[model samples]
Target: MNSANGSAWDDWDDEVDLLVFGAGAAGMTAALIAHHEGLNVLVCEKTAAVGGITSTSGGTTWVPGTQLSVDAGVPDSVDDARRFLQSVVGARGGDAAREAFLQSGPLAIDELQRISDVKFVAAAAHPDYVTGPGAAFGGRALAPLPFDARVLGKDFARVRPPRKEFMGLGGMMVNRNDLGALLSPFASVGNLKRTLEVVGRYCVDRLSYPRGTQLVMGNALAARLYYSLRKRDVPVRFDAPLVELIREQGRVTGAVAGSADGSRRRIRARLGVVLATGGLTRHPVLRKQLFPVAAQPLSLSPDTHTGDGIASALAAAARLEDGGDSPGLWMPCSIRRAPDGNDHVWPHIILDRAKPGLIAVNSRGERFVNESNSYHDFVMGMLRDAGDGQSVPAHLIVDAAFIRDYGLGLLMPGRSRARIAEFERSGYLVKGDTLEQLASKLGVDAAGLARTVQAYNRDAAAGKDPAFNRGASPMSRFNGDPAQKPNPCIRPLGDGPYYAVTVWPADLACSAGLSGTANGEVLDANGAVIPGLFACGNDLASIFRGTYPGPGTTLGPAIVFGWRIAKFVAGKLDQAPAGERSRATACANQPS
Candidate 1:
């Protein structure tokens, strides 16, 4: 979206109090908040569906000191979260946005629930990704409560589906909590009961729905926000991408949107236009300039993201900023040809990596990082090792026992036996009758692979990881199998007939974007706010300066800033303090 040609537009085809450039969590949330304040809002979605990449995410929100935490009786305070952020990200450029996020997170949550259909439940045992001063073992991260997609009736189809690889049983979206029950239905009566109910519901749902109607994780969050908008009758134009920002005498006041019929319409926002168009992940030019060339950056964001909002903002005098520790939040994604013959990318975020009996190896077949660490951290390790470009396309070496016990990516436990040949044929799963054969097939140094495995096995037996401390962190242990050993994250390589999956660093979202303020105002290069121009979601530079602190880091800030943008436009940005903020300030004010 460029403003050079947009300046010629004269009359408006449509008008609203607020115009949102995306239909993702950030944009939808902003529209919802603005609609609640009696502002007429319209959302333009680039794709046919409502959710962006977030619909495929884990749907966690790491906002501290909410009623959900108190209701769950989870011990947490905002001050602790603040200190945790400070430890992980010291003196970042977006400190104002960070403090604003901390102060307004709980308040935003409260305001959202009071006015919209959004709901969250405190996670009982979610740990922060990094351990630092005042780090939370739990309580800070909350998950979206599972949403019954049937509420939307036919409109449910508009909610984007999760990645094909992430789903089970032909589009059944089984969440983490119910996975064990589904995997081992007869193991216990409770398991059997839940499995039966779940499967039975899916069977009935398939009669009319393309997928199961019970949605969880990011899908649920997206659906909830979408339903809130629908309830308010807010108009959302699908397949409409922002073409350009309409600046009236230096302030962004509207946008030109493109329709599927190849028509363009100037939609004016009486209050302001909010840029929330995913991010620069798919932008042809910006991706190269910002991403590390050595790391071979890939993105999980939608194809339609393509820098529409950011480009439009830049054309309107909004400045883009970069130079963070990392250009984007990353995951080690395993790619394979799916049943539909499309290349499927599975983000190795939580499953199997931290489990026993798997070690990630570079081209030389040596471990370069802690396999049990967070996905973002793990990919950062990959970038560090691959800066010279020789260590990339790392393989996750696993024994047959590891597959049997904890299935590799896209392979459900016990299901690999039937699909192994197909996956192997597709070059997705590499199998070896012996370690040497596997190393040769994977083009890894056989001698190096042997030595690495030997050292890892010795360390596993002793329940220690002196090299990288794989299982030392609380978060690492949380991702591991607790039943296994003294170190839940470590186990020796089992009997041969090993397998390996190739992985590459993929960004889940861009860390850099248009410079913006705590009030959601996009700024010029001189640090002055561009009047009436606001950016949220990934359109704004990350508040943490590219440091991933915990689960829901992306969604938490997006949702909060969405609310802040709406409040600012409605002239109520400084409304009476939420009780949650007072508690947070009180905790921060108290002496050590």
Candidate 2:
């Protein structure tokens, strides 16, 4: 099945030393690093454009012990990162993988910066997700390349702008504080000035040289990597999606890719194939298999991440190993369909507990989970709710204050407000002139909700969150109103004209896939390695197991693993002993 085994390149064929399957952040980073190492590289993207969800995401890369932290005057240590990872992953965290990630992260950043015109700024305020036990308050997360999109020449037109719900350009990195500033209303002159400053910077970038500078975190990252690869004359093909991987004796040799224009091409890799084609949240069958929840779809990840690469690896693995227990999933997230028909996902429990006037309740109209806890815990509560036959449609309760303060329901200025009212009238949003009335409207016992609110206020007044033990981390502060003394996020919802937006538990892209060692070597279910095949990003099981350790942890691991794969292919790690080989009985044996 290995189409890449022989030199099938005819006169019209182009050849390169490396072939990268995705041009998103992870693939782009890997391609840039390899290209910087003086290796010829080719990046083929399924999308007509490069920069996958990374362009749409808050472009932050979390890495411990980096120059960004040191230079920014924030302090962090490797020990802190290790302790945090261990606490989050328990015994499942591997020392080699952790070490590889930490050690290679900064080096990867530096190497890429040296070869490309990329710039990075530190997100000093972006604290570790949990600063309580073994986590640091600073220096772990780094922002995306601080780029002025004016440099991309004609490539700028292809960039996606940052969604207004969050601040920062495609490449401009910001943390919770920045997010707060964006979400906050024009209540202060300082905020207005800050907003103007950001806008002015973009205006300047637009007027300076380029006619259309599509500047954002994603575009900036893409431009830097794409330009760097192009500078080395690396071949890039767009709308080309890999269909299958060819293997010989348990080693992948090449891939068969079909282009959007109905052209098929065979690309053979001499070194190896990197499977970064993303996870299966976008695949309906995979979503049903993985989530098993009826009628609910995930919304956090792009629609393109359907675990195609993972499926391919699983197929190859089935031929290599038998009865492999698919890795467990880290199930979190709450999603509502966007007005544009896409899922609008946020760490719901986190956002509600962090932001005021938002609380999640089960169909019985009672609060079930710790509203202020991490996303994983919140999703677990929803899962439990689903099992109980209780329509755990999470209801986001807010008022005019919330609407005036922050953009609601993913609708921004110039966007239609019809969806918000539609959901409300359709019973998805419960609104009333009083708290009890709103609760009554939503099918919850009015007294129960009222009691819950009273209890929450008492906790807020005491500056203590006894229910969820929130306020322990800085992340929750963004959810509260600073003017509210004691507990900022714990205000009572007894105000007049209360509103409730039903929140539904939605999936983010699946965080589980082909099991691989820390070295990124694709391993069978029996812990055996498949030579010349590697996977990273959403294509492999996350190092954090089922929990998101912090922001940028995903991208951090991607960069490290991508770098590790490149180096391993170049024979840089002699310590990486090839493991035993085993095949799967069928690709279907792997997890959904």
Candidate 3:
């Protein structure tokens, strides 16, 4: 084999049955499945860390019809799942990709749990993001069981930590179930015991490690997959990025990768190559092309995701899907500069908006959205109301009571007076002594804000919202604080020391990318499959198009298609001639 630059290269540097381009959930799943099928696998990651955005995510998978859900007494069927997707997606890209996802998602979850340490539990109370035609109040979303990161030994450092804003007590990770205990540590004896147990574990783990080892959410999911890979002795190379896709007769067979020192090597993959390099959210040019508006610098995804995989696939003549209504999944994020002068982003997933006593208002100090809706829908409201960027930075208004109970972005509840003073002094939170003062501080019309609050308080007293119907839907109430009576998402913004935070439109994941078939094979401009090449994760065009169906829609399809590609490659390798198999084995055994 000779290099493209005409350099003499008679032998390959490395070879494997399958070469995976990214180390996120999709690529790791593919590598693990391939290794289990008696095939040699290699994973190359562009960043210094292994997990992509998946490590920083919620780590929930919206896979229906799983044994976990069945055991939890949640009734879910494939037909129902299909109907749910169809109702949300609605003839966007046909039903083939959605059908593939529904059939393979449960099987992928079951097989991974059987073969590896990956375990999942059903989130029985989590509702679908929308209360559409086929929405399920329960039995869809599954989160990874909490994992002990100490099992990874020294390799734990390779797992990217969760977002700083998502962590608590310095660098300790907490799940949804743990938040209640921590919030009301002195509420009951059991609560106190649970809080002490969690804090004690974190305190002990922090003595020897930079962060706690009690991993949850996306970090747990990524660690589980990485642990399975290490157990199978799969080799993963960090700081190695794909430079080119090697092809033979228009079929992608291998890749050229570059090292940190600018050195290059050719690695032949006899079976196939999988692209799972997150998505195109961070690519400035691509973001401009795909997004409805010019994207902001802030994103919920890790900064390492720069659309390299999407670019490579496009250069190989892969087609990008542009028929979706929106090209990316959105979330409202608040940014605050740390002492180190770097911007820290806090994604508003489940914190302040849905809780009672908070409302989102535009520049005119007018309420624009039902703040209790999902993050995606909330941001869509922002975009729709954004007339020439007026709503780009929407204001979330809350009162002293709300801030004391629920807290605002980056501002935890039950803070001491000193801590509140620090946040206000640092300009992370804007506080005013009255509604008119708060409106002035937020640069909105004081009269408009006062009128809005007056009407809202009257409705809250009556237990109904005539405007926007804040708590009318199942999803709205699902995210709302159940402790609040009447409407969980509606309350009067009363008292002094009102606060406001500026939120910008940020994408959690892109809903559009390379077009691919149901089998995960990349498709060209004419919708023809590009043999020996496949994409999964955010690298592949989303099955739901631009619509968000549920909590784990992105990750669910990613895991399933990753599994699908591995199975497809294994079958292809089995049908290859003996000589080709021998060459692949010989090449795989060669030393770097």
Candidate 4:
């Protein structure tokens, strides 16, 4: 039904050597690599801007065995990372694609550094989210260096700004170091100087740009990749969305794309068409089928990720990987309404959840999960806690000291207790003079909450969390307040006044996608390759089998597989033989 194998009709509006269907990190990286390898490339973005979900992410790419890891003194290797993934994901997919990712991840990063402006630095102490035989303390995760969007000049408009709630001072973007100075500008002379410089630059940028030109995190990663492609003159069409693939003579040829003004064009691809259109998270039918009913209508991914690429691939007879333990990567988010009538979903990601003096509880007012755990695990715990039919959203209970020290979801740290009045009025923040009062306001069991707090405070004072073991892992401690004594993630809530923000589970990215070969070719249901078609990014099934191994689990495989797809199309990649693929898959399926 998807392939058009009738009489050949070649009335193309435009043609290129490679047609990339998304402008996200994966698509941009693929387009850049292909252009450098002598292919004329075109990147089509569904939205009017670049940086699909990547612009709002942390932009950390997890690639092991790189020279940067060695230079940073992190003793990590590909073998260790493999073991880590195997333990977390089990025998899913037999890990054929995962093994390919391990072999090429470091090489992909090195090639990007050598051929493009894409730069990354290994974090010295960013521990893995879980501790085990293959886990390393650091070096496997690489953060993209901040970039100046001013370098793009007018082209800066093409880059999507981060989520509105994430920006400070209206539209000013702040890096981690710059934010520290901005928050405590009056604390020290150095902080004041840095704040002044940062603010001054942002003010100047606001005159010409809609947001601050100083980009960091995922925005920086997207900007750097976009700029590199711009330098190479690779044309990226804004507002052009792929409609369907053009198949002729038993091979996928090009596509029918829709334009901004609602016109469609028949475009041709000489070499190949790479499907990297985010994922199927927003697809109405697929989302209902893949996500939990509780997770409906609340996804952190871009709205453009409506499964267009995957749907088109399915029509082309591509098979999908079935039955992943976790169909989508998750985050615990607290939402707030903006003046523009849009809801702001603030992801509780390594911000305040792991700090001391904070606790998350269910409808019964009982702690169900370790508040200091990774966001994914925390959300998984939330879903598991719902087995008893509590219908109520999870509540994170904190106090005045917690707000001033670590802040709640959208609340900034070091803010005064008085600053919470506006939030309380908006119903985003709940307050009570006592634990009983707070329980009433939050619809929680009053006596159960009091008992939980009494026991929690006593244990916290002794620097332990026996109930849920909050700070027992390397990840929990790494993201916790290092200043806290004994156990950095443990602390008792003070007397009297209490506050809370409701937490809901949200999907950050979809892992279920089209099944493909290690060489990046789209495979049909019968295990036959679809000529001239390939997939990457969220469009390709996750190598981790929907398991969250660590930071950049999604982007790492996205870039590696995308690069390999381009190389394979260029006839420069060495495809794994049938026997080798079988043996590798079998071995990876063995017990950890």
TM-score of each: 0.94, 0.83, 0.94, 0.95
Ranking by TM-score: 4, 1, 3, 2
Candidate that scores best on TM-score? 4
Error of 3 at 47 (Å): 1.7
Candidate 4's TM-score reads: 0.95
Q: What is the lDDT of every predicted structure here?
A: 0.85, 0.62, 0.83, 0.85
lDDT, candidate 2, at 572: 56
Worst ten-residue run, lDDT, model 1? 579-588
State the local distance difference test value for candidate 1. Answer: 0.85
What's the lDDT for residue 489 in model 3? 84
Clash count, one per candidate: 0, 27, 0, 0
Q: Residue 135 of model 3: what lDDT?
A: 75
Q: What tens-digit string does per-residue lDDT give for candidate 3 at 1-592?
A: 2235423334779978899999999999999998988889999999888889899999999998888888778877878877777788886764777777777777888999999988888887788997766678878898999999999999999999998878888899988887988988999999999999999999999888989999999999999999999988999998888888876656676888888888998988877789999988887789877776634556788777888888888888899986387788888988887788988788888878888999888878888888888888889888887767767788988888887898888888878788888888877888989988888888888998888888888898876789998899888887788888987887787878788888998888888889987778788899777766789999998888888878988889889889977876776323221122222223333443
**Per-residue lDDT of 204-295 in model 1, one digit per residue for the tens?**
99999999999999999999999999989999999899988877556566788999999999887777788899989888898888898854
Candidate 1 colliding pairs: none
Which pairs clash in model 4? none
The Cα error of candidate 1 at residue 478, in Å, is: 0.4
- Tens-place lDDT digits, model 4, residues 1-592: 2345533545678888789999999999889989988888988889988999989888988888788898788867999988887787777764777888888888899999999999999988888887777987799899999899889999998998898888988998787767778888998999999999999998998889888998989999999999999999999998999899988765677888899999987778877789999989998988888877776758899877899999999988889874387778899999887666778789999878999999998888899889988888888888776666452379999988898877898888787646788788778889999999999999999998999999999999999999998889888999899999999999999987999999888888888888888867788899877877889999988877767878888888888888887776665666653432322222212332
478: Cα error in model 4, Å: 1.0
lDDT of 2 by residue, 40-124 (tens): 6777788766666666565667888777788889867777777777777677645566667876777777666666666677766
Indicate the residue-level lDDT of 443 in model 4. Answer: 92
